[model samples]
Target: MNRRRRQWALKKNLLRAAVLSFAVSCASNAAFADDEHRGRDDDHSGRHPKVEHVLLVSFDGLHEQDVARCIASNACPNIALLAKAGTTYTNAHTPGLSDSFPGLAALVTGGTPKTAGLFYDVSYDRTLYAPSDTSCTGLQGWNVVFDETTGIDAMNGGALTHLDGGGGFNPQAIPHAKIDGVCKPVYPHDYLKTNTVFEVIKQKLPGARTAWADKHAWGYDWLNGPSGRGVDDLMRTEINSTDPATGTDYTDVYSHTEKFDDLHVQAIINQIDGKDSKGDATVGVPTLLGTNFQTLSVAQKAPVAKGGGYLDASFTPGPQVSAAIGYLDTSLGRMVAELKQRGLYRSTAIIVTSKHGQSPADHTKLVKNGDTLSKLLESNNYFDASGNFGQANTKSGSLNDGTGLTGTGFIQTDDVGLVWLRDQKQLAAAVKTLKDNLSCNAPGICADGPGAYILYGAPLRARFGNPAEGRTPDIIVQPNPGVIYTTSTKKDAEHGGNAPDDNHLGLVVFVPGAPGAGERVRDRVETTQVAPTILQMLGLAPKLLKAVVSEGTQPLPGCEERRF
Candidate 1:
């Protein structure tokens, strides 16, 4: 009887061991399944399931009307394809000046000039010293010109001639600022007042990478923001530099500009392939990567007689413009194909938009005033005795010349006028002078009925910012829609104005596998919203960006709804 009891006890112990082993095996399998599901559905810590990358492409001069017309005519099949799964914002616009510096800043920083502290590429800063004044003791106000002349070989007088802009910004051309009571050179990255999307992402998502490619190797350094290392990979292909094959500035011809744009296109492809911009190093794919195509912008700026601009007021593209648009469409198609091939199509979000749009789509309305605003101001003794309109002092004497302020102020003009006066007391007199000489025939601004107007005083302060703070323009002149304040004979249209064509942009947010048959959010949106939207898509808080918090910038519509 004792032996039987022992055998029964042994059998019960064996049965308990088997049951325990089965439960342990089942639990292990369940844990593995959970991990697999998490990998697929909770890639970004379960915050967003679809988007792991955001590719932001800026077609420099693309307009909202251009998108509509292209789609209707089937000229932009690739853009149309993206539109099929995207939310097209018809009334999107740049919040401030349409110049490239502020335009790009608005897209990445989520703020206008007021918060970003960037007015133009070549603008005036009252608190900073001139590039020549390394001691920072010569003058408090300097014409901060971060252009081609700021390139690395700028002092050698051959920066623009090289395809790489002499390997980036020249240290000599950078402006000086007084920090900690010491004079310090202010690089492009240090000039901006706000943090960028790249910086925000780096702080929030430690492992994510960011990259960008633009026209100027030097001037575009502002995109790096105050952190100075915001972009992990900033390509150095300069668009304004002379292409060796053509022996002319990239923008001098549309075809040449296309070749220049191809470099950036390839760079984007390399980034997508989990390689560095040069396609050499094996860095993982960046979370945020993009580039700007200058071909369309060059096409729009080309002289109408050379088959550029719209053929009519109905937004019809001329032969050259049409060709440029088609080239951009093809390039975009290549990127889309690359994304799909890598199985990243369902995980990537592409944002297509423009920094600013070319003005006077109506070719007949174009008025090339030929630096009339600056000349008018100069003739009125607004500049020094040497007639220097705060031109940058560079070895090449490229854009502007000598700089010594004995007279009233400096003037920067494109399609509009941005006047910065040394003496604030002359504001009223300057406004009176500008208003007194508004004529199309005279060597001054043209009057296109009620469209032309001047902004200054409290109104200008409200619209832009307080001029007393030094960076804001003392006076702003929004000329007629078709007026371009340039003397260059190469182009019929210009940007950097508040005209409908200049501010109105083509904004499309495309997410693969998104619900709905592509909605059109006609509600007006600003390019500033793009920065916040990018962060939100990454499962990161938009408020991580300082500008978003300060400006109260919201994400683009349909983003929160995951509509596209």
Candidate 2:
């Protein structure tokens, strides 16, 4: 965690009266969150008006401005009202590289990518040795043992057959679950080794209830991976075969986004309205409730305007900000209404956040700069068939044409550039050629030898061992800030780096009645602190959840109380 920053969790003294009111008002329903508080007495426990529940909601690509911006644009009134009743982080951020893998890992586990060995979806693992072969059939690089059916796959269907069959997406090659002796599909939750904040709550808050809901791939990243450390029930889009038994949807990925948010809302809404699936518990306050909406595509503060439903291109706010903010507002409105109806609205802790921010997929200045890096590779014969070739694990990989040579193309992932060479013995020659040709390429890259450089590469054997685990890369190239790859397909927004816009996401906390509840805090807080904070609020030991927190890999810091 970042230590050079200001204290983030300064306890507010003014919360006493509010806390007292909370206890009296919610004593009938929520109690110790989970089994961790079994021996504790609700009445005599020193902590007064303690948190009964915590609801964490994560939007896929919402920036802080989505609240304020869409509000001013009149696209999201519900979310704007939420800000009015809570604190908003104008400068909240994610890890350096804003890729989904590390970003979400930092948020839930409070651990950095470096610790989780999650620098990127495809990173360099130093343990296993990769075979020298580079082909489309080579599916050993990523550290994850299983194929996680995140939002991407969920949105498409309940199965990841397409991604896995493509060779490049196969999880069978990963050594962790490599049952070449006997093939067995690994579940999504099996990939994470760290305990999440939820796990802590389960340990400390014996009776308190906890839950989560969020975007596609991101939801699974937390629901089944690191964040699952403590949650009792969850609503996400992960397609794990074992999910059904655990109260998760085993095959509901094809539902609409509104249904996505609504599924959670309806579940909690039913609880708030005082009716369980079996009609057991009466309408009562829950220990926790959470769900997310796509603020990037809808207004977060307004009522759905007839057919104008925000997504209509004819709508105002130029269709971009309107849809995102509007949808966020709609989701919030529904949730708040449900709380208001339950009469337990006074004691709920509601947290709102975005998985990441947005960036122009095709920024003007970025385009010109990317060209410089391209030229450097071309000049170095890096793209030349005689020099570089592909035998990757997909249709895009090189074909082994007898001489151990393949295609002469490149693999552009997130913002990192990967290069494959025909011969391992030619690595030294390639490095020299790149440096010699680098200055001419200029804008897009830096030599990466010493300080302040961007381009870095080495033998897969030297950097990370096995290519089968998807950890090894022959050459690693990071682009200059703001620059992205300009392939045939184009996009208006993109994210996958440590840049400010990419790393800095939005954060909102809305506990029902804490004294600091409605105050907007501009203090910078890292996502890693979230995991510890969850444990702290629930009176759980942070040590138990440390494996999930990002210490060095992310810019987030450990949670600190106000000393003064």
RMSD, one per candidate, in order: 10.3, 11.3
Task: Please report, in order, the local distance difference test score of every candidate based on alpha carbons.
Answer: 0.80, 0.46
The runs of at least 3 residues in candidate 2 whose Cα sits more than 4 Å from the true structure, single-residue gaps closed, are 1-48, 72-74, 121-187, 207-210, 214-222, 225-230, 236-261, 267-317, 361-363, 366-412, 416-478, 547-564
Cα error, residue 341 of model 2, in Å, equals 2.0
- Put down candidate 2 lDDT per residue, 250-300, tens digits, no spaces: 322212334445555676676566554223556343455555554342221
Give the C-alpha lDDT of model 1.
0.80
Q: Distance (Å) between predicted and true CA of 393, model 1?
A: 5.7
lDDT of 1 by residue, 161-252 (tens): 77667876675567778899899989989999999999988878879899999988877888888989899999887777776776777878
Error of 2 at 453 (Å): 5.1
| Shift in Å, residue 490, candidate 1 | 0.9
